[model samples]
Target: MDFLHSGLAAIQRHLAFVAVDPIDWKFYVQAFSWTVTLFESYLLLRQYPLYSKTSPPESLARHIGQEDFEKSQKYGKDKAQFALFSKLFSQCIDSAMLQYGFYAWCWKAAGSILGKFGYGGDYEILQSIVFSFTMYLLSSLPTLPLSVYSTFVLEERHGFNKVTPGLFISDLLKGWLIAFVLGAPFLAAFLYIFQWAGDRFVPWLMGFMISFQFIMVILYPTVIQPLFNKLTPLSDGELRSRVEGLAGKLHFPLKHLYEIDGSKRSSHSNAYFFGLPWSKHIVIFDTLMQQSKPEEVEAVLAHELGHWYYLHPTKMMAISQIHIFSILALFPAFLHAPPLLRSFDFPKAVAARPPTIVAFLLFQMILTPMEAFISIGMNAVSRHFEWEADRFACELQDRLKEESMTDMGDRLGRALITLHVKNLSTVWVDWLYSAYHHSHPTLTERLKALESFQAKRAKKE
Candidate 1:
């Protein structure tokens, strides 16, 4: 503890200028945020032209029918245009808000709302909660039109939207309700820890954040997900048998197998597993089952289980802890910086004693450039994990010593191709755009890698 305190103290001293310096933090934030936004827009520009191609690549031409390829190209072009427009639109709103003191106004508005209910500024946590939701609800309003257009217009045009207007509104309201229910207590606990631990909040806060993640892992499947979609146990059949057999062979603590009604809202398909280390549940989208063969689905699960075998999720969580700690460790210098808040147009009284929430929020804005770089690195690591999982699926026969699984790689490849075609996923991608945004390798990349894995395994055999 002493060593940690000393280490953190040294960091705080290095950043001590933040506390007393009269820096134009808001200007820096605007510059950094705009730089990220414009660079992303440029990447989209680089990628937009790919959608104009008249044919699929030679490798995928056999897999995708002419009609499907054209449809996917059209979908990709439409989405790219929407993305380019929405990115600029959202950035305009954000830039205007910052230029005109929206955040500072929100803090005061939250205090006023609380005052009406007999609460006062003395309740900083309550004010912070109110301020957070205020920002969330208001800031989200500007993008609601885009969301509706994407769901109803774009997706509906492409024959993927399964949502009615009524369902959409209901989902929106439920989302708000859930956010408040979960976020309020979480924010309160977060602020309380800072107040209690003072300068020593890093380790304590890291523990809390990790604990919250574990709780969410348990809650999301059992409670929160059911509210959005149904998750019935996969009916006893070949798919279930294969999945269970695979799990048992791997000695995975397979607790439950469910098929989700993902088609209830969208035609997108996926499957994943989650739970504690001792027990886990696998949920497959009904659309996935409808689209692929039993063997192909089994191969997909083999790849998913590979993620478990290699501890990808745990490694990602560890990286996230380091990210969070880095943020918290460098926070104290900003925590009391009156000028940081003042530059954002906060009133003198409010700026004099920076609220933890305000300080944290502003600090995050200051980290726009750093966060963008971190996102690229994280995506690279994620893509590497995906490659490993693909190889694992390919080599499953060797791992389990099962002759029946020798062709798992081909099955997985077919499954992935089917998924991409059904979802109208873009085939041609810009390398720079993909590095910045995509968490998985492109279909061609994965397919090529899968073939290599198969060849290597054949040589070993």
Candidate 2:
């Protein structure tokens, strides 16, 4: 009893020390980010048991074979187990850095090192650039092995990995090069704006950000994507003709259809409509075209076109801009908070004016909780749009191809099931997890929506 009492006392003293030692926003940053990590880990862990115990619903059972069903279960379990380990690893590294002021120490050390090389001024662009690069290098190195293992080992074991070591290394080098090329100038400009524009910097920075994102949207398919993968004009075929006809009927400004070499990376299939209004292009993954029938592929394209018709992407961009604006609006308070700086072990003088990069990093860590909630809402909106798009695909296919709603629904259903099998993805997930993370509805949910639409149309007929 005495030993037990003394042990309890020691534990209480340790808790008190942890709680009261860092009375600054850094403590909250550490706490909040860690809590969010643990919460996400809990979510994934909870879903596993629920998912493993649940049998395939009758509707799903009709499409997915029992053997495939079991495979998916194992797949989910394996992925979940790895994900838990990954999350824990990430949290340990991040929590250690935040708690031990390693990032803060790095920032100061990087600045001092840069100063010796004549790159140090009051927030010198060169210093900030070098500092940012060093931080990225350090953080990325730790995570790279996990990603490599996930790709080469776990995914390979599951038969999903197509990335060879040479390709993987090439991808990494190209990605880093692209980041340095694009990010350096943008970051330099951002720091310069903050340093020079004084109070008006917020709006200017926001405007610049909004513009940058828009430009990226326009350029990604044409300029950026071609850097990594080969893209060719979709071959002339019945599918291409049908796609063009459908585009014409919908009055979608489709310029060219391109097929991207997605199979080189993974067997997963996807299609998207991207680029500026005049330069709009539809990119179908080669894997998707190879796997899907013309009708199913057409249905997929119809769904993508529906997004434009409903202005879903535009609305999403608007939401994203609002999120950015809100965060930027709060930046002044976060930037000026001395306790936030001191909590990271910044000296009193440095705390008076926290560096922009430090401020951004701290803000991101502190905003984890808010971002999680916001993400849920965004995902909800996205799922709704996906349903709308699915409905549009059904309606358009019925109108153009002279197919019954049921026919179109079955095609969509078959395509989804095939995708699930090819990707080795689980058929269903926990409702809460799906709601928070999935922007697209489950196969069962989508089929139900399509069936409901069919029933309503039959009644009208």
Candidate 3:
């Protein structure tokens, strides 16, 4: 811990010049952000051509019928077109916001609102909370129509949208309410740490963030998720029995098994498990049950369990903590830099003693290019984890010495194909586009890997 602080202090000293340098941070931010946006748009253009392909990849050809394959292609094309336009549209809105100093205006507006409530600038934490929500609400407003069109028109045409107009409105309101209910206290505590800890905020902030994630892991399933979707204990029968038996064999600490009403929003089919190390719950989407057989669903659970067994989630969390630490460690210099705030058109008085939230927000904007690259790295790591999980599922028969589980790989492959067909997920992905965007191996890639895994096991036998 002492060494960590020493390192952070060293970094702060090295970047101390940032406090006095008159860099045009705003121009750099704008240039880099637009560059990323355009590059992403280019990736979409690369991927857009693949959607015109007439059929699924040759490996997937046997699994997907011609009509279903055509549907997937059409769906992919439609989604890609929407994505291209939406990406450009959003960038334009954000670019305009930056060009006109919307962030500076937002901070002032937050102060105005805070003053109306009898709070002064001395209440920085309270003011920060107001500033956050004000920015979130106002910035999000411009993109809300895009979200609406995606859900109502685009998804509806794809025959996947299960959201009614009234339900959509209700969900939106509930989401905003939940955001306020949770976000205010979290933001207050976050800013308070900066005050309480002063320059030694990095380690403490990391601890708080990690604790919050743990809390969310508990609250999301039990409280927040239940608000959005129904989760009934999976009905007793072959599926439940199979899942329980698999869990027992793997010693997965199975606590509660649930079937979530995922079809209430969309026809997407999936399953996942989450909880602390000791107690875990598995939730399967009802749509998955409706689409695939009991055994196939069991196979899907097996693949998910593979993730748990390999500690993928924990590893991912650790990686995120490091990412956060990197961001926080470099923040103190920027936090004290008046020029950074001024570059974005903040008032000289406000910029001189910059608010923590304002500085952090600008710092993040300056990190746009870096974050874009970090996402590519994270995606690579996630895709590797997915491969390992698939392999783990393939070899489960050997791990448990269960004869009945011999065809787990085949079952998983079938489930993957069914899911892709049902969801109309893009198949024939451009390699470069996929490297940037995909967090999991494509369906054909996974199926081919599974085939090799089965073959390898057979050879060992």
CA shift of 38, model 1, Å: 0.4
**lDDT of candidate model 2 versus the reference:** 0.79
After the best TM-score superposition of candidate 3, give how far the Cα of residue 125 lies from its true spot, in angstroms: 0.9
Q: After best superposition, candidate 3 residue 124: deviation in angstroms?
A: 0.8
Taking all chains together, each candidate's TM-score versus the true structure is 0.99, 0.91, 0.99
Report the C-alpha displacement of residue 331, candidate 1, in angstroms. Answer: 0.9
Alpha-carbon runs more than 4 Å astray in model 2: 1-23, 51-55, 397-406
Pairs of residues clashing in candidate 2: none
Error of 1 at 386 (Å): 0.4
Model 3 poorest 10 in a row by lDDT: 52-61
| TM-score winner between candidates 2 and 3 | 3
For 256-356, candidate 1 gives per-residue lDDT tens digits of 99999999999999999999999999999999999999999999999999999999999999998899999999999999899999999999999999999
Worst 10 residues of 1 by lDDT: 452-461
lDDT of 3 by residue, 330-434 (tens): 999999999999999999999999999999999999999999999999999999999999999999999999999999999999999999999998888998899
lDDT of 2 by residue, 187-241 (tens): 9988888888754466788889988888788667767788889989999998898
The candidate maximizing lDDT is 1
